[model samples]
Target: MRADRLVSLVLLLRQHGRLSATALSRELEVSTRTVLRDIEALSAAGVPVYAERGRHGGFALLPGFQSELTGLNHDEALALLVAGSRRGAQAFGLGSALASAMRKVVDALPESHRATAAGAVQRLLIDPETDLLARRTDTEEVPDTVVTEVRRAVFAGHKLRIHYAAADQAPKWRTVDPIGLVTVRGQGYLLATRSGSDRTYRLSRILAAKQLAEPAQRPDRVDLDRAWQERSTRFRTGGDQVTVLARVNPSRRGDLVGTALAVRAEEEADADGWLRMELTFQDSRHAEWALWQLATNAEVVAPQWLRTSLRDRAAALATCYGVSS
Candidate 1:
């Protein structure tokens, strides 16, 4: 309460310039004696506070007085309130500081303006989607330290020395330059340039990583933005343009169009509301993945060889599992 009142007194003096003892006491919810004592305290603490006796007399800060509250305009003041409130509630070590800072600003406002600023703070608050964040972060919780270093390396164009473990091998250390970092459904990937080859490293596979002091330089800049385009162009320029015709159920049409592997070239609807889509796949692996992803919602209608290969692979998998074929 002492701290709050002291800041409030500073704010009142900074904003109102001059007010009578009656007005100051009423605004601060204290007596005239308390207001006088606060003024003496401010003076003793080297604050340029003084009482002026006139028609417009109360308490005022010196004209040259500079506080964080002094320089803020309307937009900055509102932004500060909104950001501080959001940070205070969501992040640690912010709420008390923000509340204290807000009190200081409020104390500087004229008696008339204080209510509006306080009301704005009350009305605007941020509540993030707790359920969605829970579902996302639950599946994969990468160490915060690894994420921090990866972000730093990506931005600074530095190579990373990392201990990479894979399904087939024991963990081993390698130096790779990070191109981009992406997080999907709580799974993080580092699209990296490794020894002149492009690859995507799962964050889960990374045992430990640190940004190297030496900077990474790419020879003939591989545009990370154009990675999909590069893959597409490679397919277009390659031999044997394989075409796929698929009949997709209406309920699953969204899944087809939205998926990265399947690029729909044409779409047609039937009386039954099912969608027949002409989807292009870059290669056999791309098509197989898309078909498996779509499951019972789609069936291949063209390219006999590719269809036969899918069946053959399925049969082989069934054989391995000792299922009746």
Candidate 2:
């Protein structure tokens, strides 16, 4: 761990030119005294580290001293390049660090593989802005300050006070014990607890956030995957769950499954090649919303109310389009 810290200290100085012991301590999550001792150790090992004493003075390395720590193979360099292409780091407030690390990785690569690996990275794309249908996927915008504070609270094991606005609701302040942060499909969420009950808040919905000084009321260690899975199970089982029986065109099977919460059962295909299936949704509105997207490709078979709702909507749509039944 100390070795890693020393390497990081060198890299920090190399990147920023100069940084104070206080800044180093904060960045490294250590202490000022530790930073001083590490600086001395680096100098003793002929690292050319020097310190300046003044109001604006800090530690710096000799001019043009670059470390030769580039030991990445061709495949390793390409892998790092591909990983850097993802926008996940931006959601985690590590965009700048990822970019910096990518730059250093490329610079450290051997001359022969540098250009080739970079050129290969351009040929691959991850999470394109628009899909094949020309419809763009919306990305949630999160304030840097909000993400930073929430992240600090999660790592430091402190309670977080946030002003969050849920859908169609007024924003209000709430104190939550942050367990972890999760990002799905470019949208970030803070998985926390309030009054020992699970709560999930969208990061973009946070209007303001403050990291409280009091220690968070949570376990010392948490298994994020298990917690997330449990939350998902509760969510899937809890809401106003409704099951809809429908017959859908085979070509539109992917679309239906993607929008529905779960597929309850599948029946044999009809003479016309339409597949019958029972699908679960959150509520009537959810079932209506999803079926509406399928248009004529799917038909609701059971739960007469849902069929009537879809028919009414279709009738209204036809009326607006001036089509006579």
Candidate 3:
């Protein structure tokens, strides 16, 4: 690991001369002291590197120094730079490896190509933290050790035992034959099977994971995309789905629609600036959460249980806040 870091240091110096110790450490994700030590190591290894004493000056290699690594063409380097800009590598527990690879890719390109690739990738953003509406997206955090174990089992075709905590349930250990891992919209899922029946587990819900030595019983090859789509279809069609008729404020209509699986019907805005609609949700709990998020902006007209539940919740809140019952 130190050897790789040393080589990366040299490549970095050759690519961008006169980088400050702080800058180098930031690029390498190391401490400033580590950068200083690396500089000493490089100098002792006969690298013609020198430091300049000034506010703007830093370390630089001897003139005409260039690495012997083959350079990437403009388009090739740009493609890698673009892909590295995405958060996909983090899903597979390869974030650091991807960062190192990205540095190598930049070092392998000619100066002209490097500039072009950097500009191209900067212009193309992917998987931003927030959307145009300013609503932040949820980021599911999975522990590194758990991800590593899951990846190991998936690649080695071994059975995995995971302590999974499903919604509204106690945590329990389950052994699964892992098919693969899938990431969508920042959330990760493990596609596996238990007793020959397909099961998809959210990676964030996994409290712990252990790779078993026993081989997994799965197909030699799988179409992961197709498998994910099939599972999604089953989930959408098979559930304790509930339909609700609601009159919602015009501005909150989009927020309500976003949570529903389907909008069966919608009416134009009434004189009171409210719109009537029929929406279906995955379950009653999901419906409650969605309408709850809207507060008084959306009113549930049908599904008497939902209305009563919301009313009771409001009453509790009022009592807690010392408002009249």
lDDT of 2 by residue, 35-89 (tens): 9999999999999999888999999999988787544443234335436445556
Question: Alpha-carbon error at 147 in model 3, in Å?
Answer: 1.7
lDDT of 1 at 40: 89
TM per prediction: 0.44, 0.72, 0.79
Tens-digit lDDT track for model 3 on 1-325? 6776777788778767789999999988899999999999989988889999888999999998766544433323433543543555566666655566677778777778998997897897677889999988776889989988998899899999999999999999999999998877778899999999999999999999999999999999999999999999899778899999999999988899898888999999989989999999999999999999999799999999999999999999888999555
For all candidates in order, the CA lDDT equals 0.67, 0.84, 0.85
Q: Order the candidate numbers by lDDT, best to worst.
A: 3, 2, 1
lDDT of 1 by residue, 216-257 (tens): 765446566577456446646565444588778888878776
> Relative to the unseen true structure, what is the Cα RMSD of model 1?
13.2
Superposed by TM-score, candidate 1 places the C-alpha of residue 274 at a distance from the truth, in angstroms, of: 3.1
Could you tell which candidate, 1 or 2, scores higher by lDDT? 2
Pick out the ten consecutive residues of candidate 1 with the lowest summed lDDT.
Answer: 87-96
Q: How many clashes in each structure?
A: 5, 0, 0
lDDT measured at residue 86 in model 2 versus the true structure, 0 to 100? 57
Candidate 1 TM-score to native: 0.44
